[model samples]
Target chain A: MMDILSEMLGYAFLVRALVVGALVSACAALLGVSLVLKRYSMIGDGLSHVGFGSLALATALHAAPLAVAIPVVIAAAFLLLRLSQSSKIKGDAAIALISTGSLAVGVVIISRTSGMNTDVCNYLFGSILAMNRIDVYLSVALAVTVLFLFILFYNKLFAITFDETFAKATGVKTGVYNMVVAFLTAITIVVGMRMMGAMLISSLIVFPALTSMRVFRKFKSVTVCSVFVSLACFFVGVVISYVYATPTGASIVIINIFAFLLFWLVRVLMTKRVAVKKPGLVLLMPLLLLAACGKSETAALPEGSAAQAAFVLEYPSQRGEAPAQAWLRQADTQGEADAATPVIEIKEKMFITQINDIYLNAGDYIGKTIKLEGIFRLEQYEGRQYRYVLRYGPGCCGNDGNAGFEVSWQPRTPAGAAPSQKAYPKQDDWVRALGTLQTYEEDGYPYVYLVLSSLSVLDTRGAEFVTQ
Target chain B: MEKDRPKDPQGIPSEPLILCKNLSLGYDGHIVLRDFDLRICAGDYCCVIGENGCGKTTLVRGLLGLISPIRGTIAFGAKIRRTEIGYLSQQEAAKQDFPAGVYEIVLSGGIGAMGLRPFYSRGEKQKAEAALMRLGMAGFRNRCFRELSGGQKRRVLIARALCAAKKLLVLDEPSAGLDPLAREEVYRLLKDVNRETGMTIVMISHDIAAVEKYATVVVTLGKEINAVGVGGEKK
Candidate 1:
């Protein structure tokens, strides 16, 4: 271990990772106790998904990913918190909804502009090796902020976490404390997301508290143990990940699980000796066993049917839009089929497979007029209307992938007279669209779409869903 | 029951610590208990008894200001701020495996008194320590809370509440899961605390025998609210 540590610390990136890892680990562990006890353990998961979406957006825009992702994820955390507080939405359900939706948004952004860049994978699976000096600095600063705030409100957090109702009665603003926890968790997730990946960042927040709880029963002891365990596991996991060439996020998560198992074994041994003293532990062990089995449920909730049916970018999902080329066509009998202009006609059999290629290699198709036969979808999202000409493709897991290219619909001749909602075909209408392939940017992320010269409803609808 | 207490000359109460007039309480737009007019005064050992789902717990919540009244007004006395009222909810109110020491839990009672100061004052610490000693929980100060017996946990919670409260302590089902001996011990502790501190207590309990034996006032609620007392005032 000494040899490995000396050699590993020689690399600047590894050193950066170690510093940030130790700091973030301690921060996550401190906040994790409150989150786990409050039954908001999955807030970490939810905030990470929101982080993924913002990172994708930042990358596509060529903006600083962390600079853009931090605020966005914080807002998302607040949103998830408020949603969970509502009587209509259950906490887990609220977490599931926001996390999956953000995941879908991320996928749509990746599918449109950058087709699964390795940077995206690092965010998904963690890459401590990729840390830069700036990331280390940011992580250090943010981690310090989190730790400072947590310490400053330690007693209040304890009061609320132990019993929110009681704490509220005593004059501690439960809402403010809860928001503080949420805000701190958001910062921790964003800073940690770079190294741990969105898929595995939640483990850093959950594993330590849980492991400490297995053997230690006092809150202060459990918290101190959690922070210590998190730091120790993080370093060990980093070393193992480097030595074994495994994903850093997975390695850390596995180490945490191992620690939890070891502590659980010790607890069981202690239980046998102290049999009559701890009935709650012995009686609740089965229930805890069920929970342990359920812990493997990492985020990756099924995409909603709306997202599944129309996985289209340029749909803006909600970052407002820029006014682009507009031509609402009844029918363009004369297509833009000049000798210089290339026209690619999509084959009916290969339509599902070909759209994927077009989206993936957008540089090749830009400025070319493409004619395709597919469904016309008019979507109303967050008070903004978007039009798409698309078809369904094979989904990973369930409804993970879909092919929908946004068709920019603006009539240039009608000067400021945007196409009325009635002018477009109804949602899910089968139509043949001929338009020039194009890309537009919003929030720095480029989105591929079609500028239609001709869009008319078709009498015959092609295959709606396809495996090809 | 204590026989040497002085009864108020008037049958009707005045200058109540907590006054509820036509108060309607519910959650998520569903009214569980409504039209509750109650007045809890100082130095009253009042026990609220009712069937399950009759809003016994809801009344406690309303009194604690955890949930606002849907229709009516719930007022506190001139000297009492909402934060000064210490509340001990039902057993399940706190997580069973909460990783806290007996002293840490008791010390947390000072959280309400700490408005903006992050750390507890020396005086507050002394108060917590005194409350712990008074409750005979000084020996369990360093012990883990989850390892304590149900009755012991109750005593620790009461001690913590004492640290927060200057005049009022609200308890919900303090004797819920205790054995007969433990139950008697809890009642005796409460009686002693009430007699010694002269602090007003509003406790929700199902033990009619204990209520008759210990409580100075009996406030029954189910179909209606009736408050009658020996040394305490009637409502």
Candidate 2:
């Protein structure tokens, strides 16, 4: 366990993931108390779905994703607030309608444009590898801003959440404070989406508050305990995910569920002393069972080093074109299309699938230099250590898909400045490897590989996962 | 209560603190009370008596400025901002389930008077404590509101109202669910508060006997202001 912990700590991505998780956890808990008390807890789910749709739209339009998503999700929050106030639609029903509709729209957009690849799937389930430096900085800035604003309006929020009518009667602009709450919640959801995913972000906003409420009766105590509990749960969840290779978002939510149950159990045990009554035990049973169902088989790393195997940079075989680009090259099959077709440039959104397609059909692009970025995984086969650039794509859910390209050093690094000299990346270090594409046969099947001209281990900590 | 007597700059005791002229009150464009006229003087202990759905609650709400009047003008006294008149709404829907202590609920009453300040000031806390003490609920300050008996909750709410009101208090059915003894106790407390401090009190109730015994003024409501009379007035 210590070995795994130390090894995991060596990677910058893991550190970035933990930091972002903590920031978001604290921010969510602070707002969660008010949101839960106000009966607007589901707004988190509503806004997250809106964020998913906005993220998909931004990805499709090739816009700066957060820039597009933040404003759109904030607007959706206000819209939900207005819709809930309208007599025609109830609050819960409004949330359900907006959330499901936005989720469906997001799914449709992803399927239409990105063709339902791993990148899109990551957004659904979340990937810690998605946290690059930009994301960390953004999360930190926004999380701090949210925490500050929440504290600035803490008392007013307490009044509004507990008794909005009374708060208004007491001369509070309850409408303005309500808007402030909604706006802060929207920001928390959108910023948290990268690490927690659209599907599970609401758990962070709900479970901590509920858990704290189970034991504490005072609003101030509940809020303070909620922040501490949420941050603790998130820390433990991240550590569990790191050690067991579990899905980060689900692990965090599962931890929160357990914390809630534990707090409830403590409450039950202290019932004689505390005079507390448990109201929702019957309703909680199935929910606890549902949370338990989040367990999935841990994804394993791929084995066998491609470095020992002789790689021929030249392809003697003719596979007309990569299957993804087959339609564009259909007319050129007779060998007259070299000059007519431009090289297919792989974008971040489609990099995983494109690299996979190129590997599966390695004959089309032999000498072309392709630039790709992913976590670096080092494995040993036949006494030769090989570093593979890997990425986890959407495969049903968080537990399943692993797709990546093997990096083959051109004029392989001299033995003197070998693995010992340069710290070979641990299992999940984000790196940008630029190399000429090569094909090598393993057993009998040919696989596309990268022959590195220059490798720069990218510092993409807090970076968003690629979603096309 | 003697030391805390209401300091009204208008020395004339008959001056109205709240006046409603030809008022129509209801919700959503449906008028419940039409052409209702009433005057509440600074030291009046007014008991508004009515049958169910006769617009007593609507009249009180309109007077509190919670709802707008359909036609007439309801004016506040010179120094009275709408919020300065403390109001205790009818037993809110399952408010006992709220996770607050008696002290917290009482302290919240002063939230409006806190202005832009985020935290309660020392003076506000002392006032809340004094309000609790006045209702003989100082011992229950830290007790959870949900665990309190219905009668205890009423006293706490009355204390909360005291925290908000500087000159006037309006309560709607403050003794609705209590037993007769608890109801009498609450009535006595209100009567004392009104008599000793000269804080104008308006309450909606069905207990005509209590109203006759405790009220300085009585306004009977039925579709409109049916009767207004001075009952057991000190003057």
Each model's Cα RMSD? 16.7, 12.4
Which tens-of-lDDT digit does each residue in A1-468 have in candidate 2? 344445456544566666777888898999998888777888999999999999898988878777889899989999998887677899889999999999899889887886665566666777665444555688789888999988878877776776666566545677788888889889998888877889999999999999988877777777888887888788667766654547778998998888888888867876856544543342343344333432331222121112112111222322333222332233223223232443334434334435544553455568676666677887777666667876654465453565666776643333311333323444665565566676665546555667664455443331223321
Please give the range of 10 consecutive residues that has the lowest summed lDDT in model 1 chain A: A296-305
Instruction: Give the CAPRI class of candidate 1.
Output: medium
- Judged by TM-score, which candidate is best? 2
In the order shown, the candidates' DockQ scores are 0.53, 0.46
Native contact recovery (fnat) for each candidate is 0.88, 0.39
Error of 1 at A209 (Å): 1.5
Off by over 4 Å in 1: A1-3, A129-132, A272-468, B1-14, B231-233
Q: After superposition, how far is residue A311 of candidate 1 from its true place, in Å?
A: 43
TM-score to native of every candidate shown: 0.69, 0.73
Model 2 pairs in collision: A118-A394, A131-A461, A131-A462, A131-A463, A132-A460, A132-A461, A132-A462, A132-A463, A133-A461, A135-A462
- Provide the TM-score, chain A, model 1: 0.60
Per-model chain B TM-scores are 0.89, 0.88
